[model samples]
Target: MRITSKVLITLLIVVAITACFSLITHLSNESQPVGDEIPARILISQTPLSTPLFVAKKLGLFKLHGIDITLIPCNGGVECMSMMTHGKAQYATISESVAMFNSFRDTDFSIISTFVTSDDDLKLLALPRRGFTSIRDLKGKSIGVIKSSASEFYLDSLLLASGMKPTDIERVYLKPDKLIQMMKIGKVDAISSWEPWGYRAQATMDVVNLGFQGMYTLSFNLATMNRKDETSHERSKRILAALQQAITWIQDHPEKAKAIVSDTLNIENNQLDWMWRDYVFRLSMTNVLLANLQLQARWALEHNLVEGKQPDLRSILDRSALQAMQDEVVGQ
Candidate 1:
């Protein structure tokens, strides 16, 4: 075919437009960022038990996983859930059973992973003035707890094992630090608390020993998230990955972990050592943990903390990401 000047001009213009469009597309693609810097806000309670998370964050583990983690410190797990409900944080490290039972009682709040499993670190503290030697002697007396917090379950379990029902004692709800003050003022007979508070009560109040739930049952420690849309799924996985690495690093480096915890939580070196020795920092979601969680769920039901309905354990916990991590390590 013979090409006319008009046809040649038109072809040239079309080709120019196509080239320009391609260039624009390429420029646009180049302008957009490639790195994903999704910020992960984590809710933590101020205590030795929850200090490792802060240690991990401060040490840049979360950043290693491509997450910008913001640690939101709260009083306890119950307050942490409030932060989760109000969209204050993406993920939270709290008591697995406490969060689950509360969710069962109210909304269906679910936790993703169980980081710290053992509850052997918890202490049943009695003020020196109370003259309480054991759980039996503490019957019919007031016991301070965080109300719907993890310590509440600990208190309940302690009472149950001691042949005392919940109705046998007057339950008092107070913050960790306040519990120590209340006990000092003779407001309550005993208090069930974790780490620093128990440690403080022993030091400040010179409290008498009741008993400890040592290696008793694996209570949920951290890695709890609300059941949201898929928008947070990948983010959740990444956050867990960071946390898993942090826990593993702590396990591998106990001296470093102890120093970090002591500095972060403002506890003495010996106290930090006690916490490290008492609690297992293993982040595995093992069968033993699952069994204990189920038992906790059942206990919630029995104690009317879950009402008539029970939380579907499978739906509440997503262990795929955790399982994958385990598999990857084992495969390596």
Candidate 2:
């Protein structure tokens, strides 16, 4: 009887220990991304910024990294950042300025990487008949700009760069896509915008490049909402890893990469060729980018673009996912 009671007690203890471990294992599995899990959602702007993302989707790079992506196409970075701001989407491809502007409202957001720098991507085009061949020529002419966008601010930068003030020129507000058509018809003397609209306008309208001053280039960045969940963090790292790989593939195969972007967007050959030169794609956030962000933030503040009194540079750059990915690569 004594032996029977001891055996039963020992069996009960073993069963309890096994059950505890089993429960732990189950919870652990639930926290990690499953191989057959649904695709992670990312809001992407329809621009060169999303070219690599499209390539990744086409090449199955995201799936290779165990991150199936569902891309929600947005017209511009403002809309893209809005999705992140509302928590409707966790990730987006946005302009450094757009991200910087929105970061004022939410500290939970961060720019993980700056993937492209535009040199001459932001261009100033003049109507050929206007004979406005330089930025100085636009001193008193009305310029078309997309209000509430980098277009408007960049026009200010262009003017300031040329020793002119915003007050020196009248600003005509127009959407980026419509700027070209309006300019072609003489609606505005000059238009300031980013590619491929800039490229498209120059080509279609016999417009002259007043300035390819995209030298003070607007950069495009990958941003996300920083979540506390381990799963979310893990997924973010995977997304970056996949993007890094896609960028590598893009560099090594320029023609192929262009084809991917062109085909996806159904772009004309000339437009694709011309606009492609303006983009320099890579993954990084440099001092130049930081400085640009700061400058733009101040511009936004002065323009009443944000409610915050000042910019928060720290909140804008949450590199935790980037650092985590680097550590993982090192570990591997």
Candidate 3:
């Protein structure tokens, strides 16, 4: 009887141990995406403002987070957002205004985290040779702006604040880089844009800021396709964590960050020096952000930039990934 009881006890213990092992295996598989098996492709805007992600990639922070990422470099956030919107990429860094405009289509993308913020980033660069010194002076004069991007919204705000209607000036829709050329040749009297294009205008035509987006900050955010799966949630957290970690590295090592950006973007260190301090990189989402997005959407709607209904500002924000980051930091 004692021998039989021992054999039965050993069998029960073995079965319990096998079940525990199986449970752990299942969890390990479900908790995170198999990085070796599947890689996440993200779209990165090839701008100095995207220095953190670049630093992260250079330092292998993404890999440290167990994520395999393939970055597709784009000229601007709008371009980045376009690729992500079409499912060509899983993630993107898009400007707040561009993201707001794209949200009208209800794409798979959602704003997961804000990358950078600046009060005087977006400015109306007026050619000094044309006697355009102030925002109000640009009235009734031709103003070159990039349509359907932040440039468009910023121009509208400037016009509104000056109590001038859009029709009061010749709204010459042009690409940001082209705006500088247009001003140089006297095609437009003023141009509303964001750097480094704004800086380009200043250098070439000696353009001075007639106005700044002080009240409406020029912000950039990181976004990804919205997915409800646990694996997706974990992956998003991992990406943010990697980026957050990189931001610390950037703040700690500005010269190293600048060198990486200069090599990657082909920007001269001298050129970067002027606009470097304008940017503040961080991961944040606040009520002010929400209000800015909503206001931007309304501006797009009123300006006929988009048709039909507006998107829910709250719906576009998925902070679970950010919350996960907070938990991890506190845990550490």
> TM-score for each prediction?
0.81, 0.83, 0.85
lDDT (0 to 1) per candidate: 0.71, 0.78, 0.81
Clashes of each: 0, 0, 0
> How does candidate 2 fare on TM-score?
0.83
lDDT of 1: 0.71
Winning candidate number (lDDT)? 3
**Per-residue lDDT for 55-154 in model 3, tens only?**
8889887887778888898867777887887888888888888878888877567888897887877778876777777777876889898777888888
Q: What does candidate 1's lDDT look like per residue over 1-332, in tens digits?
A: 99999999999999999999999998775334325767778888776667558767877866766677788888777777778767888666677656666656554455667766555667778865556778888778998887666677777877777778889888898877788888788898888777677667776657875766563554545554554565466566666667777787787887887788777777798777656666766665556655666777787778776566665666656676677656655764
lDDT of 2 by residue, 127-152 (tens): 76777777888877888987666777
Best by TM-score: 3
TM-score winner, 2 or 3:
3
lDDT of candidate 3 vs native? 0.81
Local error of candidate 3 at 167, Å?
1.5
Judged by whole-model lDDT over C-alpha atoms, candidate 2 comes out at: 0.78
Error of 2 at 282 (Å): 1.4
